[model samples]
Each structure stands twice: as C-alpha cells, then as structure tokens.
Target: MLAKRIIPCLDVKDGRVVKGKQFIHLRDAGDPVELAMFYNEEGADELVFLDISASSEGRNTMVNVVRSVASQLNIPFTVGGGIHSLENIKALLRAGADKVSLNSSAVKTPELITAGSDFFGRQCIVCAIDAKFDKDSGFYRVYIHGGQKRTEWDAIEWAKKAVSLGAGEILLTSMDRDGEKNGFELNLTRKISESVDVPVIASGGAGKLSDFSDVFIRGEADAALAASVFHYKETSVKQVKAYLKQEGVAIR
Candidate 1:
C-alpha cells in the first residue's frame, strides 16, 4: 500500500507565512523559508506553498519567495495561487515547483487543466477547491479567490469534473472548519474522496493528533494538510506520524 502523505502548508502573503480563519484576519505565522526547511528535515512527506492573496489581488505568484523556499528543500513541493496559464505553470516549475495547483483559474477556464495536463501531465496539476456549507442546500458550496467569491459549482460535482479534466489530485479545504482547530470536515472529505479516483488532500480544522488520524482512517483522505497546529508547535510532524502509525494508518 502507498503510505499516506503528511504535508505542511505555507500560506504566504508578502513573502511571509500567515494563517487565518475563513481566509480573513490574517496573522503572521513564521518565515516561509525557515519553516519549510524545518519541515523538510522533520520528515514531511511533501510541502505546499500557496500565495494566498495573489488571485484576489489580481497578480502573479511571488516568485522570489517561491524560489527561495524551493531552493532549500530536497522534498517535492507544490505551488499554487494566481496560476492562470501554461506560461505561469511553466515559470513556477522552472523555479522548482514539483506541481502546480489551480483554483479560480481552473474555474474560469477549465481548459487550463487539460492544457496543463497535456503539457506537464496530469500528475503535475493539483485542483484546489475551497468549499463552505450552505444551510439552505445542505451541501457544500465551492468558493474561489481566497474564499471571497461563491460559485454555482457544487463541491462534489466540481471534484468529479476536475478529475475528468486531468487533475491528478484534489486539495479540498473546508472554509467552515479552517483555522478553527476543531477537526476536519470528515463528511466533506469522504464525499470528495469517494467521488474522485485521484488522491484527495484534506485541509482545515485539524486541532489535535487524533484529528489527523481521524481524517485518514475515517475521512479517507490520501493526505492531511495543516498549518497552525504545526506552525505554532502545538504538534510536531514526527509526533503526528507516530500517532498515525499507532492508530494503524499507513505512513512513510
């Protein structure tokens, strides 16, 4: 069996790592480069860097910071935010990104997924979806631009479409649970994981070590991505891995 991946996410803004609830009221977490190198040495399965404000600000990725972070890591890392075209994807890969994640760009032009997959292969493209619950519909609604805009897209349906369009993996974040440190939105995670054949990365709401195990064993996520819990030293990657192993979840 393929061991489940444990990923540390660096949500960046202005060249520094930051975190917030529902993607607002941002607070500084740490320096991206320093945190990334630490995670790399600490047995992180993979690393993800997201220029959290690029799309909303209507600009390109912060390349300098990405280059700095990528240069120090031997582990594979994925870059996202404001990736809108093949050119942008190529630029990021050239700067050392192992994979490129697409969110609002894919929603506006899904053909980008095919283009990216054609140019770089499906495994090189990760489809990131930020979703929130809709009480009226009793279903999750997909959001974009750092959860600032709502689309008509159903979260589950979008996951299926992304896979069909050649997305190799799904990075699903539940806005409702994000930064609350409660626990993962297991039902939403399971829904997308079951709906798609590719890997699904569960993000948001991981408070304790058990949260990680719960998401993998119960939520069925291929990987668990968290920020604050790891950033603030509330938990360590090594500790989380030990707990997951004890709980019978496969890990590297």
Candidate 2:
C-alpha cells in the first residue's frame, strides 16, 4: 500500500503565506520560503503553496515566491490559484512546482485540465474542490472564486469529471469545516475518494492528531493537508508523523 502523506499548506496572498477561518478573516502565517524550509526539515511529506490572491499581479508575484520556496525544499511541492491557462501551468512548473492545482479556472474552462495533463502529464494536475454541504440538494456543492461563488456542479460529480479530464489528484476541502478545528468531512472526502481513481488529498477541519488518523482510515483519503495546525507552532510535522506511526498509520 502507498503510505499516507502529510502536507503543509502555504496560502499566499501577496507573496506572503496567510491562513484564515472558513476562507475569511485572514491573518499572517509566515514567509512562504521560511515555512517551506522548516517543513522540509520537520519531516513533511510534501508542501503546497496556494496563490490565494488570484490576480495577474499576484500570479507573477507567486512565480518568484514559488521559485524561492522550491529552492528551499527537498520534498514535493504543489502550487495553486490564478491558474487559468496552459501557460499559467507552464510558468509554475518551470518555477519548480511539482504539480499545479486548479479550481476557478477549471470550472470556467474544463479543457484546461486535459490540456495540462496532455502537456505535463496527469500527475502534474491537481483538481481542488472547495465544497459546502447543501441541505436542499443533499449533496456537497462546489464553491469557486475562493468559496465566494457556488457552481452548479456537485462535488462528487466534479471530481469524477476532473479525473476524466486528466486531473491525477483531487484536493478536497470542506468550506464549512475549513479552519473549524474539528475533523475532516469524512462523507465528502469518501464520496470523492470512492468516485475517482486519482489520489484524494483531504483538506480542512483537522484539529488534532486523531483527525489525521481518522481521515486516513475513515475518510479513506490518500493524504491530509493542514495549515494552522502546522503554523503558529501548534504541532510540528514530525510530531504528527510520529503520532501517526504510533497509531499504526503508514507514513513516508
């Protein structure tokens, strides 16, 4: 069996890493390059840098930041946000991102997924879904533009469609559970995990060590990504990996 991965996320807005609760009330985390280096030494399986700014200026700013962060890490690195075209993916990949994550742009132009995979291989593309449970529809609804807009697609269907279009991984985040510090949205994670063949990285709602174990075993997630828990000195990646090892969860 492939070992479960533990990843630290850097949500960059203006060339600086930031974190927030449920996608609002943002606060500073730290320098993306500094955090990247710390996590690399701290035993993190991978690092994810998200350009949450999603602006033309921000995208350019992120390229330089990604290059700097990439230089400091020996582990796999993934970058997301403001990725709309094949050229955008190319820029980040050239800047040393192991993979490129897509959300808003993919929703606007589904072909980008196929194009990205065709040019860079499916492994280079990650489809990130920010989902919120819809009581009326009884399904997890996909949110785009940083959870500010709701799409007509259901989270499960979108995951399937993205995989079909050549996305090799699904980055699933529950908007309601984001920064809630409870646990992952198991149902949402499992549904997408089961629906698609690609690896699913469960995001949001990770409050404690047990949450990681639970997401791996119960949610059936291939990996777990967290931000605040790792930032602010709440828990180190080495500590989480040790706990997972003690709990009998395979780790790298």
Candidate 3:
C-alpha cells in the first residue's frame, strides 16, 4: 500500500495566514512564510496554501505569498483560490507550486480541469470540493466561492466527474466539519473516495490523533489535512504520524 500523507493547510486572507470555523469567524494564525517553513521542518508530507478570499474578492491568488512560502518549503505544496485560468496556473507553477487546486473555477468551467491537466499533466491539477451534508436532501452538496456559494452538484458525483476530466487528486473538505475538531465526515469522505479512482485528501475536523487514523483506515483517504489543530499546536505532525503508525497505517 502507498504510504498515507499528512498535510498542513495554510488558509490565507489578505496575505495573512488565518483559521476559521465553518469558513467564517476568521482569526489570525501567523505569517504564511514562517508557518510554511515551520511545517517543512516539522516533517509534513506536503503543504496546502489557499487564499481564502481571493475568489470572493475577484482577484488572482497572492503570487508573492506563494513564491515566498514555496521558497521555504522542501516538501511539495499546492496553491489554490482565485485560480481561474491556465495562465494563472502557469504563473503559480513558475512561482513554485507543485500543484494548483481549482474549486469555483472548475465548477464554473470544468473544461479548465481537462485543459489544465492536458497542458500541465494530471499530477499538477487538484480539484478541491467543499461540501456540506444536507440533512433534508441526504446528499452532500458542493459549495464554492470559499464556501459562500452553494451548487447543486452532489459531492460524490462531482468527484467522479472531476477524475474523468483529468484531475489527478481530490481535496475534499467537509464544510460542516471545518474547525469542529470532532472528526472527519467519514461517510461523506468514504463515499467519495470509493467512487473516484483518484487519490482523495480528506480535510477538516481533525482534532485528536485518532481522527487521523480513523480517516485513513475507515474513510480510506489517501491523505488527511487539518488547520486549527496543527496551527494552534494542539497536536503536531510527528504525533499524528506516530499514532497512525501505531495503528498500522503506513506513513513516510
């Protein structure tokens, strides 16, 4: 089996790294460049930098921030938010992002996924799906524009479609679980992971070390991503990996 990955996410708003609950009530975390370097030294398998407000603000991702953070990282990182065109992807790649994640843009124009993967290999493209479980509908609904806009797309259906369109990986976030620290939405994550052939990185609601183990073993996620727990020093990457290793989940 491939080793499962542990990734730290840096959500940036106005160039400062921030964290929030359910995508609102933002609070300052730290400097992006400093946090990136810290995660690099902390043995994170990869890092994710997302400009939380870029899309809503109608602007491109902060390229200078990407460059500064990417320069400090030894491990691969993915950058997202406000990335709407092939040129934007190219610019970020030049700025040193190993992969570019598309959320609102991909939902708006799926062709961008195929076109991006065609121009810059499938491995360079990651489709980020922010989903919230609807109690009345009995299906996870996709959200975009940094979780402000709701779409009719079913999370599982969209994951399959994204892979068919050449997305190499899926970054699936549970909007309901964001910063909850309860645990991952196992059923939601597992359904999508099982439905798609591409790797799935489960994001949100990572509180205890056991949560990571559960997501990998039960959710079957190839990677597990968290923000507040890691950012607030509630747990460290080494601690999580150690617990996962104890639980028989292969780790690098």
Which model scores highest in lDDT?
2
TM-score of 3: 0.91
Report the lDDT tens digits of candidate 3 across residue range 138-205: 99999998899999999999999999999999999999998799999899889988998889999989
Model 1: per-residue lDDT, tens digit, 1-252?
899999988878766677533222223335667777778777899999888664533234367777877888788899988888899888888888889999999999999999999998899999999999999988899999889999999999999999999999999999999999999999999999999999999999989999999999889999999888877778889999999999999899
- lDDT agreement with native, every candidate: 0.87, 0.89, 0.87
Q: How many backbone clashes does candidate 2 have?
A: 0
Candidate 1 Cα outliers beyond 4 Å, as residue runs = 19-31, 53-61
Q: In each prediction, how many residue pairs overlap at the backbone (N, C-alpha, C within less than 3 A)?
A: 0, 0, 0
Quote model 1's TM-score.
0.90
Residue 147 lDDT in candidate 2: 98
Instruction: Kindly list the per-residue Cα lDDT of model 2 for residues 55-172, writing each as its tens digit.
Output: 6787689989988877877889999988888998999999999999999999999999999999999999999999999999898999999999999999999999999999999999
In order of appearance, the predictions have TM-scores of 0.90, 0.93, 0.91
Q: In candidate 3, how many Å is residue 238 off? A: 1.2
| Model 2: how far residue 242 lies from native, Å | 1.0
- lDDT measured at residue 194 in model 3 versus the true structure, 0 to 100: 91
**RMSD in Å for model 2:** 3.7
Clashing pairs in 2: none
TM-score, ranked from best to worst: 2, 3, 1
